[model samples]
Target: MSTLTHMKPRALNLLLLLSTLPVFAQKPIIGIFESTSSGAGDNQGQPGVRVLFYQSGRQWRSYNAICQDEACLKTIVHLYPPVTTWTLFKQGKPVAKVAATTPTAYHSYSEIGVQTITNPAAVLHLERRSTPDYPDRPHAILATNLSHLTDPDNWQPAAVFPLDLTHVIQAFHKLYPHPKNCTQNTTNSPSNYHDSTYPDSQIKMDSSYLSNKTNWRMLQITLGGYLCDGPPDDAYVDHWFAISPTGEVHHLGRLMHLAGAADFAREGHSELLFQVQGGNEAGYKLFYDNFTHQAQDTVTYH
Candidate 1:
């Protein structure tokens, strides 16, 4: 009788479109979500959201191959942890859910690996979505209660305006010659000293275009200025570009500046989480790539 009421109707619409698709077997944990305070310009010394987290061993070995049986796995608080909970994306979905006590020896330091997330309701959900009418940047993505859809928003931004690195720093000095510091000046001239230069764009990167080619656009290049006057060590030292939708840039790294950017390794594109300011303040940096076939996120954060 149960089998009789079945079949037909395009096989039940192809079994309801195969249930609904999108599962990918869990593997998607790349986190970094700073809370609020200071963003009207000057003095962004945020002293609220703490309980760190670097958590990026190539997205915990590509999602630890869907858990390798440790009695089913799900309790990864840190220290010998590989996968458990990290469902706190923004601009995509899944508002809050993070865990990692930060235990490291530095094996996946694409940006100096060392995971941590104190999690106090994600600092009261980033202070009630940064009330007072929500301004814009304090690494803001604010607004979320989170109670469903586990993991789903890829951090959308393939093209929305922003790609002017003032000429990709002469192809980043002929594609990598980064050595000659002590302020001789000439890495875009921030002096031999770098404490600040960020003109903005500390957030916007979710790339993976191994030739998927839509013109390869993933940028956050801010040229700005900060001629090393002393004591301001981290502003625009963060340059990550990949223009070419007919523009052509492609540098990829300078590091520093970014509180969040995910896709972790769900491999749809995204793996950037930088937040290590002036002389390692708690430390964190994971760049990760998929522009072609380059891997990162654990080269040394030890």
Candidate 2:
């Protein structure tokens, strides 16, 4: 038998009473230290200390202990080599057995059993629950397969092509078969030829009132060459036309350039003729100044 020392009288009495409990009827008496690391100079600290209760092959026990030293704290936790049984007392009687085992030698503890659940539907539901919707919303245009241009549900008929003075004149001539040579009387040489008083006056004319000198109503046609040859994806060329009141049309001119506008308005006439090409076929308004014989302003198709 191992002799016990320094046993307090009260502790002995309590131990005797615990021995008489029903718990000791089935197993041998086991001793346990309620606290460890209490000795002098053992700066083993409280961090590595733990209280454990468990059972042996046939008895219950409990104890508290600290890791060997400060340096071995991490190693002791990793190794967990110590495992002990526990004793339980109820009303001063032993009543149950508590068993524990340390799979790791440094950190003494019993292995905990964990059950993994894998249900496809449940997992998918959980994933969907965790996912967000507002931030990940789909694009409106991407929701449908049909393009906005072709989709009848959202289709809108575009307005008819806008018509300008030049186009109106052309259309009028095309519709109403105007005589090629209209008869009209002409004066040989007007006294004030440059005077604004004779605004609509006509000069020398041939047998047919149509002056052979120069018809200011003549329309000029021009084709703009390739501005760029690539797929026209991001690039475009501006095709411009300048028509003078004298019926002389100049093509491939930049309508926006002041020089081009000057060239078109230098000739005194009733109207300034111009056209734009590239984006869409639309008519544009041309403003003319009778006094300056120049185009004052223009309103283009959007």
Candidate 3:
């Protein structure tokens, strides 16, 4: 476990040799997400879920991320929760509806701390309550699911939420209800020249810039990246904010058609260089400095 920058000559040569060898990357998993609703109206605690779309042998299973711990970090599996019913809608018209013979829940005997559902579609509209304390808040999928991963002709902005002046967390949700039909991003964007620094898989990237070069660390959200499938169908958005060293939260503007971060600098103590798609500043480069907690325009291409 060595950082790439500090590798010895032999190690660097070995790494380069390995790179030229043919290696197959894992295929993208299809389903999984954080719980948005918990049968209750008000959700609580740190969001801890690792919903999985994977294959166990020849059987395809859904490892739904559910809570089962005193600390709330540990997870448990519910294998093949009975598909009680199936309702179909065609062109927004109800076509057919059916139900299963028996309703049940199968708890796994494995203490490995994982849940698998044989019926992958059962949890399509699933929600769960982590504890009785947060009875009103149902922890479930906040955005769309796998089914909506479509092409440009098939997809559009299913919903939008606004970020206003008030520091109230509840206000943001009032403007934009949690995205229900969107899929949760599962891949961690790589930070390298050869590999992409952005996520590009069936499940996209749901990232928060938790820490960076400035050492301005706290539990405050600064930057968030949400993505859609690539180009023509390339739908993406970004949320920006600033957290002072003393713990003050400053909400910045949201980029509607954010392209990508073109460049980032650590020499100046972590600066973000990116682009946007529309409005008066159509082709301008926005340089955001993490040390000063401010964003300034560096170049104008419009």
Candidate 4:
């Protein structure tokens, strides 16, 4: 092992690549993430998700350095690009691991092209487009054509949890009571991002189990609507929870926007992948081991 040294460019690159092994000796499964909507609702062949993060052993690698501005965005297309296979997971199961292909890279975000998808119900020959929301703070996408993919198996999928929003709403009011106000975000200047008038703010909740053999929930909540005012600074709100089958509730986060639940270690359970948005910094955090043992935490922002 070499002590951290100011080595030449090529030497540094070699050292970093070698660093991926040794801890687990196993290659860390590329924890790729998407926005989790397949845009299949319209059957337009339009993917709703954008490649938000490509996690390889706690690091976002190039994206962490490039997401802050546009000038670096050009480098996305210039780099040799990542050429690796990716598996699409739906509700804690592998749907398919398409053969390795470079996803079409645009300026803002990347997606698995329709060419990669076969025998679709319907396809929309969509034009090349980019959105400010994706590259919001990070003005870039992977240069490769292997788009990080997530397809909702069915348009109206069955719920994973037996409990509903009413359960959470009761918990929220009892535990964290606040002055009644329309603003869902208390950290920003333009705090209000939803259309809720006051008493009834929009409550969005997503439920999934953290294990292959459970009906519990890895619950994600957003307190307000994001459609009206574009996107706020802190979008993934802090209301993340885990509700056990017998109805015990546990708080799982301070601030995060979930990418998806995955068994990255292939250990039969799930680890949460999230885009962490806090007051001072923003990056990705992989929260694991909540069900197996005591809940532990790890953050990879570099």
Candidate 5:
């Protein structure tokens, strides 16, 4: 009876050892080539590239290589274990080779350039191109030179005045009954130009203008003397108009204004210190009022 008890315990230990043996004996399956294609001509379209991927435990590994012909096949064979390697058969014969490094391990995959892969698990593809006229694409357009303004950061839509066209025209007519003609040049030609008798004040109007495919009924308001030699105490004003395709014109006023004083002595000549402020309707109104007051004060005092 005692001998039987000792034998039972020994038998249980032997069974446990046998159960754990399979876990370590299990080999990783490796070097499985997932995809391969034939070599086409000089290899532009198809030069023989194979992509492979495999899993070991929880981690994944991949490899990419140029497989031109049989020589490439031999190279792959050297990398993978011989007995477990499986040749990727295209049609009836082996086009490429694959093998498991161990019992369940798989090889890895990778590639260069844009390529697409589709399988039950996922689909991925990529394309490369360029866009030129994209609005957000950086470009510069100048208030004076659109081409120079090609730098996106520097370009701004032309400014408008604070007062609308109807109001601005009325104001100008009241201030200067006889409007003067503008110089015949690219920007001002065919448009009426007027200069204030006082060097510090001036106003000009352009009846026809076009921008961003829309015709503009335009106005130019200049305050402060061009000949003042230094910055003006007041600001300058700009106004814009947009005419629709139906010949309907709308006044978009007070586009921009420049203000503040210049340091004349520091730079030898009086330099205009200017600030560009506002694009919205309220902004235009504030700028127009500021410039108008400055111009009126200068006219009255000088």
Candidate 6:
């Protein structure tokens, strides 16, 4: 009756044993991938995030006909998208379920259930367990959230947290009162010169690396008009300044161009570094770099 109810007990036992092996012995695909995101950071020339994921190490592309075997195909069918809550299984039991958001972009594409990681571990136990190709040795796996994973330049560092400089701005305004000449002379009217009413909205503020140390707060300030409003002759004077915790405001220089260091954070140094432009010290320079962390100065006499 219908092939004798599927066969003899011994044959059924053999089939069950074979099916159980793949389930218990199977591994997961776990590694890091690069993702590209756009916004403020993108406008400022920094736009990349690293995506990490750990899931059943089953590959969908099957060039080999033998891989079409029922057991292997069954495992692939169960996997699904936005793999946010993926279980970390140990000894055939769920240990931990890690969750992560899937970043989306106009040009980026990600796996349905793959997670993301900012800094990946050098060696992942799950990766070593799942990858039989290097069962004894650990190797870094290369993957990406982009359709084309070969280009590193396509991915920049992840977005930074929003910078807050309210306290520093208030302190600076309090210590260094605006000049009276700014408002009295309406001919080349310096609107905000004495105006402590400087529209809090106009000034862009960010904390420099030097402030990262404990009890040491330093901030970088950029005062300028809107990009579309062209250069301000007298109504505005675009300049840069550094405010120390003690309310010591130091005028670093003026805004030169859109080109300048994104932030001192990139250098990992927590001190003021700047270059003087268009003055008696026209060709003079001062900065911190490979030579020393201490500020160094040099001048070129034309």
Quantify all predictions' global Cα lDDT against the true fold. Answer: 0.38, 0.24, 0.28, 0.41, 0.27, 0.31
3 versus 5: better TM-score goes to: 3
Query: In model 1, how many backbone clashes occur?
Result: 24
User: Which order, best to worst by lDDT?
Assistant: 4, 1, 6, 3, 5, 2
Model 2 residue 44 distance off true place after TM-score fit, in angstroms:
86
Residue 174 of model 3, lDDT score:
36
- Identify the candidate with maximal TM-score: 4
Error of 6 at 20 (Å): 84
RMSD of 5: 30.9
lDDT of 4 by residue, 49-144 (tens): 222333355433322223233332333322222343445554444544443322333233222221122322122222124466644332111112
List, residue by residue over 1-302, the lDDT tens digit for candidate 1: 43312333443343354346454533233334445432221213231222232233353321111112232122221223332354454555556665534332222222122234445445454433455676333343311112333222233344434333444544543543332223433444544543322222432333332223233445554333444444323323555665565667766555544555454445455544554433322334445453443323222112
lDDT tens digits by residue: candidate 3, 184-297:
343332321121122223222223333333333222121223432232112234444444445555544454222222112212222232233343332212323443433322
lDDT of 2 by residue, 1-302 (tens): 32222333443443455455573343222221111112122221110112222223322232222222233322222222233343333222333333323222222111111001111222222111212453221111100111111111111122212222255234333332322211222232333122111111111111111112223222222212212223221111222333334544333222221111111112332222233222322112232342122212111112
- Residue 173 lDDT in candidate 5: 45
Candidate 3: list runs displaced more than 4 Å: 1-206, 217-238, 256-268, 285-302
- lDDT for 120 in candidate 3 is 36
User: By descending TM-score, how would the candidates be arranged?
Assistant: 4, 6, 1, 3, 5, 2
- What is the model-wide C-alpha lDDT for candidate 3? 0.28
What lDDT score goes with residue 146 in model 3?
18
Runs in model 5 deviating more than 4 A are: 1-201, 205-208, 211-216, 221-230, 233-235, 241-302
Between candidates 4 and 6, the one scoring higher on TM-score is 4
